[model samples]
Target: MTAPGLFVSFEGIDGSGKSTQARLLAETLRARDRDVVLTREPGGSPGAEEIRALVLQGDPDRWSAQTELLLFTAARRDHLERTIRPALAAGRIVICDRFADSTRMYQGLSRGDLRPAVDQLHDLMIGTEPDLTFLIDMDPGQGLARAKSRATAEERFEDFGLDLQTRMRAGFLALAREFPDRIRVIDGNRAKAAVAADVLAVLEAELS
Candidate 1:
């Protein structure tokens, strides 16, 4: 029987460079002859991608915390069914840019005190968690500046400004503390190459 696959996730506030790091890790692993599926949350499947556009574009107030939670859960369910589960079942490494922890922060703590609802919904509708999660920690001010430089349509969350990013950073750190064994915190206030190196080292240690 094929060995079971590993499910990994990268998470941080906007502009924390988790996305870039995720891509870099996927590419490096592929070079080593590992089958890697690099995907993102609120996306990763066709249906989920559509939902991504809905949640990511538009104004910051486009959806309330409760509504956003439902939308995100729906997207995650579809992503799991159509993309993540199949990849892992086939023994392919699935590296996700963001996962449920993002929901726990963005929709759960950032917008309001909906963490319990987030956890309840997560347990009910989406029961899987990444085998390993990297919480890329950085200064919210710097990260927000970096994020706005891209000026992407997915600026809805970034538009919430530095205050939101600050809260998000704290929330992510708290999450890292909560799941100490599974979540590894990495300092992302360095050069991209440096951050990638730390990420690779951590992952290699895990694989070993």
Candidate 2:
């Protein structure tokens, strides 16, 4: 029988460099002859990609928090069914840019106190969690500045401004505390190479 696959996710506030790290890790693993699938939340599958455009490119207030939660859950369901599950079943490491933890922060805590609802919907529609998660921690001000510099259309969340970023940083930290065993916090204020090295070391330890 094939060994079970590993599910890994990288999460952080906008512009925290989690996306870059995810890509770098995927490249490194592939170089080592490991089968890896690099994917992202809200756009991992065809159906999820459609939902991503609807939720990410609009005005900050285009959808209410409750509405956004439902949309995200739907997207996650499709992503799991079409991308994540299949890869894991095939014994390939799945490295995702974001996962349910993002919904817990963005739709659950950022907009309002709808965490219970997010949890309920998550339990009902999507029930998978990453085996390991890297929470790249950085100052909200710097992170927001970096995010805006990119000027991507997915700036809807970044458009919320520094205050929201601050809150999100705190929320993600608290979440790390909540899931200390599975979530590893990394300081993202350093150079890209430094952060990437640290992440790789931690991941290698886990793999061993």
Which structure among the candidates has the greatest lDDT? 1
Task: Mark the 10 consecutive residues where model 2 has the least summed lDDT.
Answer: 1-10
Q: For candidate 1, write residues 1-208 as lDDT tens digits.
A: 1249899999999999999999999999999999999999999999999999999999899999999999999999999999999999999999999999999999999999999999999999988999999999999999999999997889999999999999999999999999998999999999999999999999999999
lDDT of 1 at 148: 99
Per-model TM values vs. the true structure: 0.98, 0.98
Give the deviation of candidate 1 from the true structure as CA RMSD: 1.6
lDDT of 2: 0.94
Candidate 2 Cα misplacement greater than 4 A, ranges = 1-3
lDDT, candidate 2, 1-208, per-residue tens? 1248889999999999999999999999999999999999888999999999999997899999999999999999999999999999999999999999999999899899999999999999887889999999989999999999997889899999999999999999999999998999999999999999999999999878
lDDT of 2 at 3: 45
